[model samples]
Target: MSKGVITVTDAEFETEVLTTDLPVLVYFWASWCGPCRLMSPLINLAATKYSDRLKVVKMEIDPNPLTVKQYQVEGVPALRLIKDNALLASSEGVIGKDKLLSFLDEHLNSN
Candidate 1:
């Protein structure tokens, strides 16, 4: 629940995710989505744990129509991994904290 994860939008996508030096984990969610609410806390914790190597960001798909279309995001609680302005991986649905941490560890270390 610290400010480790950044909230991103269409306006900030380029500067925040595309230009970031570190790998980016974009958590696409919506306020009304129950799974989003359930997954957010774990995502926040993962953000704090991996703050050094990865930058976690949240985007409300409803608010970021351009980004959603650009990224082809089709569902809530989706995780998109990006590096150097290119999307590396994307996963949908809610996952446990351990799985998320492992995912971060695998991708952040591989890049």
Candidate 2:
């Protein structure tokens, strides 16, 4: 677990994500996934940088099968932006910090 990242489980997915008032950024990751591990620091940065506006959450695919299946996520290190229980946009794989911030800025600005 990284700093500022909320580790969410399958049991708490709905309450933690769908019911949130702020825009939720869900990081779908796993312990065995290399890309997920690589993206951890970036995730922490986003969690702290956007702490006031966004809610950062991390969901492990193995234990959280239902949420993953429901979202139809294809791979690890998937970053999903959600609001009002709707899937707004997503990014896959290990993206650079600059691009990640750009993506976050765009979404935050639009929303």
Candidate 3:
């Protein structure tokens, strides 16, 4: 497991993300989604690449419908950056690792 990445469940979302002191990048996914599988490694890389500044976690939407609906996650492979209990950024679909890192860098750098 990456130092900054963890597999979070609905039960842990509140404490692991919304209440945490560090900025969080949440990967919203589902087992049956193809793109979710494709994006997993990149998410892990982001976890490592930005380990110092960010806490990255993957939340499976299927088993965690409450989180899914609360976040209004209509699709898989969705990434949301939250801090101070507010959403700071988000992206959808499977993007290249570079682009994904750029997205996170922009927000992480600015914050």
Candidate 4:
């Protein structure tokens, strides 16, 4: 419902994330993952800062096994950057806001 950080479901992954006109940040996280919790706020900040250029979506890996399998996610707190229905890059572990922004910036400008 929020313009910034969106909560995505497996049913909506194809239409909402892969087919989106804007670049998408798909954060794969679990409620029990400590690093995922830590990175959430920074992700929210990014969602707010890059609202126009990006869409940040969070998927709970525990509940979304199909997406986890589709993305080949080996661990929690992973992020997949998708644009134009293709995966550009993925990040594992918790990264700072600057690093996250820099990563997004690199990919967003690649096209």
lDDT for residue 40 in candidate 2, whole number 0-100: 93
Per-residue lDDT for 3 in model 3?
73
Q: Model 3 TM-score?
A: 0.94
lDDT of every predicted structure (CA atoms): 0.88, 0.90, 0.89, 0.89
Look at candidate 4 and tell me the lDDT of residue 78. 95
Q: Write the per-residue lDDT of candidate 2 for residues 8-51, one digit (tens) a residue.
A: 99899889889989898999998999888889999999999998
Choose the strongest candidate by lDDT: 2
Flag regions of model 4 displaced more than 4 Å. Answer: none
Clash count (model 1, backbone only): 0
The reply for model 1, stretches above 4 Å from the true place, is: 1-3
Candidate 2 similarity to native, TM-score: 0.94
Tens-place lDDT digits, model 1, residues 40-92: 99988988887777888999999799999998888888999999989888889
Q: Provide TM-scores for the models.
A: 0.94, 0.94, 0.94, 0.94
Q: Where is model 3 more than 4 Å wrong at Cα?
A: 1-4
